[model samples]
Structures are given as structure tokens and as C-alpha cells.
Target: MKIAVLVYGSPTASSAAATAYRYARAAIGLGHQITRVFFYGEGVHGASALAAPPQDEVNWGQRWQQLAQEHEIEMIVCIAAALRRGVLNQQEAQRHGKSAANLAAGFELSGLGQLADAALNSDRLITFGG
Candidate 1:
């Protein structure tokens, strides 16, 4: 199966983001193809490079990055939502004249078109968030 995941929860708010991460791992473990992981709304926080959780706290960003690295999953963050929430990649930061970018590795900034493509091409489009 080809599965695409949409996340809308912040990593620290609730279990939605963590659940989505587990779902992606489980799907991959079951030999399913991950078409994409689109982070929207608060979920875009999971891709913020500036995030620094406590040592005991789970750094969801690193987890997602490792997952993508090992599984080759396409991780994307909605550009609008990310910018509104203060997450920016190098290119976007330069374009917006920001001092620095805070987008984490293993993720890319894009519009809803990527999500639309995932929905149109994947066998399943799973969403995790309110």
C-alpha cells in the first residue's frame, strides 16, 4: 500500500504528532510505501530546527528526521503554516530577509500542492489531528 500522512498537531500539545510518527513507522514496517508526510498547522513545529527539548523529553523532530533518513520518506511542511508559526528553511529565510532559518533537516517547505499530489497518487491519505 502507498500511504500519505497529514499531521496537524504540535509535538508538545498532544499525542497526535507522536501517533502519526508511530503510524508511519508501523506502515513502513509492514512493508507499505510512504508517499509523503505533510506537516500542517501546529504540526509544522515538528520541523523547527530551533526546537530544543529537555534531555528527557522526546525530540520529535529528530525522530522524524531519523525515520525519513532510514525509510526515505518524503517529509514536507506547509510553507504558509510554517512561516506563520516561525519555521523557515534557508531559501525562505533568505527571501523573507530573516536573520536565520529554523527548518530542521529531512524536511522541505512547500505548498498544499504536495499534499494534493500525495492524495491524488497514494492509495491512502491518513490524517492525524483535530
Candidate 2:
């Protein structure tokens, strides 16, 4: 199966984002193809390179980045939601005259069109949290 995933909550605030990660990893382990993962709302925080978790806790952004890199999965963050939450890529930060960018590696900042396309192209679209 070709699957697309939507993550809608913050990993720091709740377990929903972690659950989504586990689901995607398990699905891929079972031989399912994950076409993309679309991060919206607080879920966009999962792609923040600036997040600093404690040594005892999992670094959600790094986990997601590694997964995307190893599996060749498309990881996308909603640009509007990200901007509203202050998660900016290098280009976006430059365009907005910010001194720094915090978007993590292995993730792309895009709009809702990418989510729409993922929904249309994948055999299944699963959403975690909201």
C-alpha cells in the first residue's frame, strides 16, 4: 500500500506526534510505502531544528529527519501554519528578514496543495491527532 500521513499535534505537548511516527515506521516495516508525511498545526514543530529536548527524551525532529532520509519519504510542513508558529526555512527566513532559520533537515516547507496531492496520490491517507 502507498500511504500518506498527516500529523496535527505537537510532540512536546502530547504523544500524538510520536504515535504518528511509530505508525509510519511500523507500516514501512510491514512493507507499505509511505509516500509522504504532511505536518500541520502544532505538528510542524516536529520539524524544528531549534528544539532542544532533554537527554532522556527523544528528539522528535531528528527522529523524523532520519526516517525520511533512510526511507526516502517526503516530509512536508505546511508553510502557513509553520510561519504562524515561527518555523522558518532558510529561504523563508531570508525573505522575511529573520536572522535565522529553524526548519530541520530532510523536511520541505510547502502549502496545502502538497497535502491535497498526497491525498490524491496515495492509496491511504491517515491522520494522527488534531
Candidate 3:
């Protein structure tokens, strides 16, 4: 099966994001294909390169990055939501005159059109978080 995941919760503030990650991993393990992982609202924090969790805590951003790398998943952050939360790519940072970009590697900032496309293309569109 082809799946697309939409995340809507913060990595630290809720378990929704972690649950999404586990679901993705399990789906892949079961020989399913994940077409896209769309991060919206507070879930955009999962793509923040500047995130610094405590030494004992798992860095969800890094975990997502690794997952994307290993599985070649299309990880996308909602441009509007991400921008509102101060998560910027290099181009966006430059355009907005921000000092730096905090978007983690393997994740791209895109529009809702991507989400629409994912929904249309995938066999299942699963939403996590809020």
C-alpha cells in the first residue's frame, strides 16, 4: 500500500509525532511504501535543525531525518505553517532577512498543494497529532 502521513503536533509537547514516526517505520517494515510525510502546524518543529533536546531525550527531528534518509521519504514542511513558526529554509531565510535557516536536512518547505497532491496520489492518507 502507498501511504501519506500528515503530522500536526509538536515533537516535544505531544506523543502524536512519535506515534507517526513509529507508524511510518512499521509500515515500511511491512513492505509498504510511504509517498510523503507532511508536517503542518506544530509538527513543523520536527524539521527544525536548531532543536536541542536534552541528553537523555530522543531528538525527534534527527530521528525523522534519519528515517527520511534510510527510506528515501519525501518529508515536507508546510510553508505557511512553518513560516509562522519561524522554521525557514535558506531561500526563505534570505527572502525574509533572517540571520539563518533552521530547517533540518532531508526536509523541504512547501505549500498545501503538496499535501493535496499526496492525498490524491496515495492509497491512504493518515493524519497524526491534532
Candidate 4:
């Protein structure tokens, strides 16, 4: 199956983000293909390289990065939502005159058109957020 996951919750605020991550892992373990993992709203935090959780806590951003690296999943953060939340890529940071880019290595900032494409092309579009 081709699956696309959309997350809109903050990595620290709720389990929605973590749950989505687990689901993606399980899906891949079961031999399902994940087309994309789209992060919108507060979920864009999952793509921020600057995210440093407590040592005892899981760094969801790093977890997602590892997952993307291992599975080659396309992890995308909504550009508008990410920018609003201070998550910027190199190009966006340059364009907005920011000091540095914070988007993690395995993630990219994109538009809703990617989400639209995911929905249209994937067999399932699972959303994990409010």
C-alpha cells in the first residue's frame, strides 16, 4: 500500500506526532510504501534541527530524521506553517533575512500542493492531529 501521513501537532505538546512516527515505522515494517510525511501547523517543529528535547526524552526531530534516512521517506514541512513557527530552510532563511536555517537534514519545506499530490497519489492519507 502507498501511504501518506500528515501531522499537525507539536512534538512536545501531544502524542499525536509520536504516534504518527510509530505508525510510519510500523507501516514500513509491514512492507507498505510511505510516499510522504507532511508536517503542518505546530507539527512543523518536528523538522526543526534546533529542537532539543530533555536528555531523558525522545527528540522527535532526530527520530524522524533517522527514520527518513533509513527508509528514504520524503518528509515535508508546510512552508507557510513552518515559517510562521520559525522553521526555515536555507533558501527561506536567506529570502527572509534570517540568521540561519533550522530545518533538519531529512526534511524539506514545501507547499500544500505536495499534500494534494500525496492525497491523490497515495492509497491512504492518514492525518494525526487536531
What would the TM-scores of all predictions be?
A: 0.96, 0.97, 0.97, 0.96
Candidate 1 lDDT over 43-122, as tens digits, reads 99999988898899888899999999988899999999999988998898999999999999889999999999999999
Candidate number that wins on lDDT, 1 or 2: 2
lDDT of 4 by residue, 9-82 (tens): 88888787899999999999999988899999989988889887789988988888888888889999999999
lDDT of 4 at 103: 91
**Ten contiguous residues with the weakest lDDT in model 4:** 45-54
lDDT tens digits, residues 64-107, model 2? 88898899999999999999999999999999999999999898
Q: In model 4, where do residues sit more than 4 Å from their true spots?
A: none
Candidate with the greatest lDDT versus the true structure: 3
The per-prediction CA RMSD against the true structure, in angstroms, equals: 0.9, 0.7, 0.7, 0.9
Residue 5 error, candidate 4, Å: 0.2
- After TM-score superposition, the amount by which residue 112's alpha carbon in candidate 3 deviates from its true location, in angstroms, is 0.4
Q: On lDDT, who's better, 3 or 4? A: 3
Clashes of each: 0, 0, 0, 0
Q: Indicate whether candidate 2 or candidate 4 has the larger TM-score.
A: 2
lDDT of 2 at 34: 93
Please report, as a residue range, the 10-residue window in candidate 1 with the lowest summed lDDT. Answer: 8-17
